[model samples]
Target chain A: MYIRAAAGISPQSSFEQILADPVPVTGSRLQCMEPDYAKLIDPKMIRRMSRIIKMGVAAAIQCLEEAGERMPDAIIAGTAYGCLGDTEVFLQKMVENDEQLLTPTAFIQSTHNTVAAQIALLLKCHSYNNTFVHRGFSFENAMTDALSLLKDGQMKTVLAGGIDEITDTSHTILKRFGLYKKEPFPAGNIFQTGSKGTIAGEGASFFVLQSEASGNDYAQLTGMDTFYKPASGEEIRQHISAFLERQNINREDIDLVISGENGDMKNDAVYDMVYQTVLSGIAHIPFKHLSGEYPTASAFALWLAANILKAGKLPGGIQTKKTPVTVLIYNHYQHIYHSLYLLAAC
Target chain B: MADLKKQIIAQLNLKDLKPEDIGDDQPLFVEGLGLDSIDALELIVLLQQEYKIKLANAEEGQSVFRSVRTMAQYITDHQGKSTA
Candidate 1:
């Protein structure tokens, strides 16, 4: 499959911002620099949508617009924390109203598939719509579904995206579990700090995926693979090696590796080992500092890699000696959901 | 009636509209306020929660939610009769 077009609303304002002047984040969480949604979405619909829904719909519409598409054959969204704000509101109302007379808006918008459904509603599209809530592997699963649908001749154009949002309630709860750095630090020093926890980040990235090249595609999605709970760093190396072999590409053919190191000592150890072993000497860049660490954060990594291949330039701070032709994106969520995506310039 | 319009706006999340923008005799559903079935459900919940009025059936919603004036009249007639 190929990435026909890619657009995202991440912690950074835009890919151009990432290349020109990436802002430094200093906090426990990195929030998306959302656009004026009134311009991107209908004001009436925007009134009812929660934060994540607005971001997801906007990113998807932007991707479709970039591809010059009105309606995609399928819309698949992956979200781990789907519509958290609406969920909080719905549950709060349930308690406040003593389980009676609860308003339908919050409850209706609180579902995991609400974002995907909302996009379909806006498009008047009754095509195949699906949402994957597979925790860390959510976005990867959605992409895989899109690839399958396209490869099987089931669909021509598919809009696949990964979306997740951070809410005060979710952030507070995850903080109690020690998921974020207790002390504020510079985002640029995420790797240097060598801390116990990573910063919380959230974003929405969407891609227009097609099986055939459009001649203007961002990059060809060479291959994707995932593993769960690999026993050791050597096991991860073997997985990467096997994946590269299946793609018929040698480790030497890869010009860049987008690493998923998130500044956590425990979370980054595997990446450190991989760098020393299988992926050593590969010009690399870490993305977590730019897009905080979230379950489906690899979506942002894929979006970055695709854009980098399309632009033929690395982001401002990332120094690479060569213009990358083949890029490898490796991301894992706390070492639980490991995924590798290979991309090449079209 | 003004408070009822305020309640309707708040309950339905009609952020773009003000109470004064809605006429007292204007219909609350399609061809009037452009609300759909979902907004109708929300208006029902608004009546129960804010006015202490329980709608007897889905059919009653057609007449009761016809206009802000009708909703206010319904509330005046039924508010204390329903249990909270």
Candidate 2:
């Protein structure tokens, strides 16, 4: 259950910024504050990788370095829309050439497993490598699978992560489906967006999880579960209790609840329903203003949870009790993919 | 091939290098420009996307992409055959 190490790149700053302070985002769509590539990759190789691939590789390398392991026993990643930028480029070529000729670079790298496979290639790791592509449950699926692997003794140390990207073409395409706000609003006031869509964002995160305890364990990843389209909010509330029951904890014992509150009036009502049902008195924190909305935004939520446990620094605009112990991460996507994660301070 | 150099620089995103920095016969992979296998693939994409010259197989790209001069020669030889 111990998370040995963690690393990520996000819209705010590097994953270490929680120890200091998070810089406020300015635009509706938050773009990642990138690290210098020279520090993490070979220039010759990075020139060929798309942005999402680069981010995933960098974070994976960071995790390996932080965990002090050159080769992990396994690698697992979750992504919803993988390598969209490369896919867009390939599609553009097919459109322009009228199917006369098309290159295979973008097509090859556009697959959902490419992120995990690329990491394995870079690390020369031939262990258990897999990827999950189930929208909001993507990262949670990875976490649950990683824990299962550890529990079953298939592996000892594993590199588990989640990655997703939002490209210009994807932004436009998803906007037609009302996935992002057409008008601009101050990112800090996302809950005040009187709009139909949420801000689009992209990020990648990696965690080194181990079966035994480590010197740098951030927290114990106690439990993870996912529920798809519950019968009603009552079902969701019951499911929350069920997850806690599996972990042998009570609802009132949860010190803080991190909720995915992307501010779409219709889509956010589900989270509101959860609050009214089960998490009314719980100290809740919101992160979509900083990380924005992505299928794997829950990865950022996990990253935030680990940081809170390790650094004990909370960013502004959220309040909590004297000292927190148990944290629950609750996220849902499009009212279809719902996930729950429990973490305890080690 | 002045335009070709600029196209290569922009397409491959050599952020530190400008178009004029590349000579006509400069090698693109490993030694001359420090590009790698992925760049070779992107060069294939460059041919299909920009010049409409499609190499039928990966083996066909080795000589055609040896340098900017070779790439230009391939394009010139396949002038009328371009689909674009």
Candidate 3:
């Protein structure tokens, strides 16, 4: 399959703006740069919409409009913490009101599949729709299933996306779990922090994928694999090598390597091993500095990787002045879920 | 009934609307306020949460919820009727 169109709403100004210069997070918290959603979302429907729904729906519509498609053959959305704001509201209302009078709107839109279902309803697309929620591997699982659908001749064009939102209350709870830093640190230097936790961030990345490469292709969706709880760094090396070998390529053949390094001193060390051992000589691109940290931050990594393949030049960071032919994307979340995706220039 | 508009605005998160925008006799459905079925459900909660009133059933809900005036009348007529 090929990625025909891609759009991401992150902490940066716009997805296109970050392709060259890294924009320091434009917010105090790692919240997405809210565009004028009034242009994309209906005023009446947006009354009860949380920020996540607005970001997700706007990004999805942007991707489809870029592809010039009114409706996709299938809609698959992957989210780690779906509708976090609404979930918190529903729960807080339950506790505050003694569980007596609760509005059903929040509870209805709190489901993980709400993004996918909303897209389906908006497009009037009654095709195969699914939502995957497997923590860090959520987006990877959705892409894997999308590949299966195309392989089985089920659908030609599929809109696959990853959406996650963060709430202050939920971020506070996650901080209690030691997911975010105890002390305030500069958001721009997140990847350089030698601390225990990284800054919390949220975003939504959407891609319109088709079976064959068309004239509007950004890059070809070559291959992807996911792993859980790999015993050691040596295991990751084995998996990386095997994945490349299946495509009749060598580890060195991959021009650029993109790793999800969120500067968590403990977990990011997992990628350090792979970098030192296998990709020591290979140029690496770090994206979490720009996107912050989230369960599906890897989805934003895909958006960056595809643009790198299209622009040929690796743009700003790193010393790779020449264009890359093949890009390898490796992402790990809290040492539990690890994934690799390969993208070749179309 | 002015309080009702404020309550609906706050509860439903209608960020753009104000109390003066909603007419007391204006219909609350598609033509007047452009509220959907979900907003209607939210209105039901708003009524119970604000006033001590319980709509007997869906059949009676239509007449009571026809307009802000009608809703205020229902609340006034059943001031002593408490659902709690």
Largest lDDT belongs to which candidate?
A: 1
For residues A1-346, could you state the per-residue lDDT of candidate 1 as single tens digits? 8999999999999888999888676888899999999989988799889999999999999999999999999999999989999999999998998998888889999999999999999999999999999999999999999999999999999999999999999999999999998976654677777678988999999999998988999999989999999998889999999999999998889999998999899999999899999998888889998999999899999999999999998985667677899999999998999999999999
The candidates' interface RMSDs, in order, read 0.8, 2.7, 1.0
Off by over 4 Å in 1: none
State the lDDT of candidate 3 residue by residue for A230-293, as single tens digits.
8987888888788778878787788899998887898789878888887778888788877778
User: Measured with DockQ on alpha carbons, how good is candidate 3?
Assistant: 0.84
Most accurate candidate by DockQ: 1
Cα-based lDDT for every prediction: 0.92, 0.83, 0.84
TM-score of every model?
Answer: 0.98, 0.88, 0.95
Ranked candidates, highest DockQ first: 1, 3, 2
Per-candidate DockQ values are 0.86, 0.50, 0.84
Q: Rank by lDDT, highest first.
A: 1, 3, 2
Location of the lowest summed lDDT over 10 successive residues in candidate 1 chain A: A184-193
* Residue pairs with clashing backbones, model 1: none
lDDT of 1 at B24: 97
Could you arrange the candidates by TM-score from highest to lowest?
A: 1, 3, 2
**CAPRI band for model 1:** high
